[model samples]
Target chain A: MSTGVKHFIAFAALAIILIALPKVFVSGSAHTMMSLMGIMIIFALSYNILLGQTGLLSFGHAVYYGLAGFCVAHAMNYIAREKIGVPLPFIPLIGAFAGLFFGALFGLISTRRAGTVFSMISLGIGELVASSALILRSFFGGEEGIPTNRTKFPPFFGYKFGPQIEVYYLIAFWCFVCIALMYALTRTPFGRMCNAVRDNPERAEFVGYSTQRVRFIAFVFSAIFAGVAGALATINFELMNSQSLGAGQSGLVLLMTYVGGVGHFIGPIIGGVIITFLQISLSDITKAWMLYFGLMFILVVMFSPGGVAGWLALHQPLLKGGRIFRLIPAYALALVPMAMLAAGLIMTIELAHRMLVDAQSDGSVMKLAGWTVDAAKAQPWMLAIGLLVCGALGLKLAWPKVREAFAAQSAEVAQ
Target chain B: MTPALSLQDVRKNFGPTEIIRGLTLDVMPRERHAIIGPNGAGKSTTFHLISGRIKPSSGSIRLNGAEITGMAPYEINRRGLSRSFQVTNIFPRLSVFENVRCGVLWSLGYRYSFWRFVDKLRDANEKAHAIVEEIGLGARRHAPAGILTYAEQRALEIGVTIAGGADVVMLDEPTAGMSKAETEQAVALIRKISEGRTLVMVEHDMSVVFGLADRISVLVYGQIIASDTPQAIRQNKAVREAYLGEEAH
Candidate 1:
């Protein structure tokens, strides 16, 4: 299918799901998921305005997101405390302009040089803003942070949004509007110049578009979207903190987008869902889930720099060339033992951490999957068997098919 | 005839070292003028100065008697003067058709189009299609320009320069790496495109120079050694000394 068609279908499906979410999922769960998706989608797409289309990687995008979020939080407080009567929908506009203002300020300096210099300046700015957030307590909420009540907003369609589900609809609506606008922006001449500047700045200059201007515009646009995401996040959480815009959360965005696929527009959406899901579900299952996630991210960076989207794109040639069914059986066959081994490893690591951290009081043990496992004990034999079987099966199933795919790719190249 | 392109006492210096030292030249209307020189003779720098890629340290350049020495490259292109680089400067990532479409966009006054889709810009698209046809790249229009053969890239470069519909067109080393057959074809294309427009090309191919140029100027050490008709340039003692040898003169 054409990429546009695929995107349309996916977007339509997502829209329908969002509209029906309150009916399906529990209100709390739906609200949380909607907020996460909304925030990440905006951030990811804004990041792509620089990274994907402009071919410029940014290390400090979180600064814009966090700053904008903080700004919106302050504005919301103003509205709540009877200091101002700033309307609810217009709050994001404040955030957007705040983002644009800071973006232009930073872009003027950062757009002068790209790559490492750009990243460093952005990093410096991120650290400065984050540290300042702590020092400036009165305007910012300081260590305690600021919280808001959404009931302050006037209701619409008989939905005052006192419930979480009502807020989810608001977030979903904003995400849809922002995504459509950003997507439409890409088809503009200004957006075309962004892509042109990425490929060849000299050519763009010769073609009469100032390369620096293009980069600056893209930077500002990305910043505005980041701000939009931040604003939505503030409304959803009803709380704003310094950590929301710090380096750690910013780094999480990089992990999400790249892990999902940076180039594909939908890649970040997939990434947001996966990471958010893991953050919720795995945090309950194991203490060392983040460690495992970190390892997976490192492996993904090293092995599939194109991200999951690139891997998906590879399936296109395979499917079109009639090698799909032939390759999948081996691929699935390789996965059976790998899953078992992963579960074993997780158990073993969690047990070891539990023993080392809190061994004195915990005397209970649980046995499952042929091993008598204590929560605070390590079974070396079980770990060793799991690793061996997993490794051997993985290598057995993966090597030949990978080789065949490469051979096919090279053959196509040769022709 | 009044000159179509003129450079007057144009001087360019990089900090302390002057690359172009008090050079003056002019191209007569509809004339095929060739500029030739040894390496580091400031030949390419002269083109850059005229194209506004670099500002002259001093002096004025006039296209059709309007001063344009210090204008930006795009502004110069808009003022009916276009130039191709010595090294092929093209959008490598764009397909051939899109590259040509970008070339046509500026001329069609669609500089910042947020409303018109590129496909819907019919006049510009048609012009680009026509340029692709003229450059004999109709078949390869869908291919990414970076993947083109060296000769094909040269052709695309010419197509791009001429696509803007400038009155005076300058091509630097237009046939640098072509075989004999390719050179002949390039010479023919150059002749075809230069009709009713002033052409100033810096060429290393003597056969192409003799076949196409109506006049020639030889430069040695940032100075014009000789400027004369092609036949006179072929026979001049100083031109031979700058090029072939004393014995040839």
Candidate 2:
């Protein structure tokens, strides 16, 4: 197929999936979670424009995400109070405005110095805005945040947005547009310049570009998309607050992008989906879920370092060459012991949590990955350590077998 | 011709030390000029001043009769002057074709544009591909530039330098670390690109310099001791004693 046709098919497939997902997973919780996933996907992708595309490490991207969200929240309130006939869907425009204004405003200072300096400036700005969010009650609504009613605005085409389904579609529409636009940007001349600045800023200047100008433009574009994502968040939760602009939120997007793989366009998409799922679902399964999240992040950074998508990218050429079956032996040798290692690690963490964190409040007895185990006893601890040792030993021995399987394919792997 | 590039009384100092002390030179339009000097004689520093990499402590540097003193590098480049570094400088992660294309983008009036796709710009793609083919890297158009062989990367650096259609080009030690064959190939490429434009280069390779330069300027201790044709410079006593040493004898 022609590339145009292929792109059409891909985007259409994405749209169909987004629409059909609600049909298959028919639950109120699923809709809530899916809506959240859409917002985060945009946020994380925008963060990549700075971190991945422009070689900028921003510790304060949530500044734009939260600032735009507040603008959107307050705009919603204004529209309702004035009965301005503006529908809820268009409120993101205000967020977009806020992003453009503030992105340019703050970008001048932040993009003046790249590398570690840019990161430090961004951190300072994030703190400044977040602190202001608490003290400026009239504007930020203090800690409770500015809560607005989505139904208060006029309906669009007879849909009141009162039901969760209508709100979900609204978010899905914005999500689709933001993603399409962001993807389009990566192919433009400006996008190439961003990459140029990232690869060699000094060379970029000699080629008739101001490195600062390229970085500043990239920062603004990133902020615009981030603003769109923030506006979507306001609609999803019906409340925008100080926590929206917190350091924790900024760190979450960073985790998503890094874990997704900064090298690929869809890396953050994979990051957004996986991280959002874990953020929501992991809490119910274990009290030490945060520990698991930290462990997974640390492992991704150290071993794979490419994030989940980058790991999958390694298998792409093999699949294309019809040699995927050759990997089965290696994969099995790796996965079997890796699973044992994960189980042992989790068991140990859970036992310690019961002793130090949960013993006084909850209990000494708890379920581990759906199995009944008493943290108070010695039997589980001994089993945990035994499995951990054996798992470590088996994985160590599996390395050569893993290397042997891919050794023949090394020619195709070097970029 | 008002000289394609004119540097009059340019000087640079860092703290207590003076690098380019009261330097002056003129490269005429379409004339190939080469600057030769010892290691710390401030040859690269002169290129830096002309290309706007650094401000002259005091001097008027002009390109095409227009004063470019204190202008930003991009502004100077926009006015049709370009340079290649002493070291191989390229966007390592970008494809070889993309690196060349980036050099041509601003000159082609697509400065900082985002609305249109780069692939769809037929004029730019054709120019970039032709230049890549000219540099003998057409086969590696899709390869990332970082992985190219050293000689190939040097050729690419030259391609990027000339791709902007600049009227005046400066190159610092373009053949600094090349084998005999590579140096000959680079000389031929440099000759082809400098046709119908002004070429200024700093070189340590004697054969390449005498072969390419219409006029050679010898710099010693941050000052030009000799500016003349190849034969005139070779026979000058001051030039031989200061830089040429026994090579000229």
Residue-level lDDT of model 1, residues B1-249, one tens digit each, is 668988888888998898888888988999999998878999999988888889998988999988887887777887888888878988787788877777777778877665656666789889999989998999999999899999999999888788878879999999998899998888889999999999999998888888889999887766777888988987888778777473345
Residue B95's lDDT within candidate 1 is 83
Q: After superposition, how far is residue B156 of candidate 2 from its true place, in Å?
A: 0.6
Chain B TM-score, candidates in order: 0.95, 0.98
As for candidate 1, its interface RMSD to one decimal place is 1.9
Error of 2 at A278 (Å): 0.4
For the record, the alpha-carbon RMSD of candidate 2 to the native fold, in angstroms, is 1.8
Q: What TM-score does each of the candidates earn? A: 0.87, 0.97
Q: What C-alpha lDDT does candidate 2 achieve relative to the native structure?
A: 0.91
Q: Runs in model 2 with CA error above 4 Å?
A: A410-415, B246-249
Q: Write the per-residue lDDT of candidate 1 for residues A183-234, one digit (tens) a residue.
A: 7777766666677778777666666666677788889999999998888888
lDDT of 2 by residue, B1-249 (tens): 698999899999998799988999999999999999888999998998899899999989999899999998999999999999989999999999999999999999999999999999999999999999999999999999999999999999999999999999898889989999999999999999999999999999999999999999999999999999999999999999998985646
Please report how far candidate 2 places residue A261 from its true position, in Å.
1.2
* Share of native C-alpha contacts between chains A and B (below 8 angstroms) recovered by candidate 2: 0.94
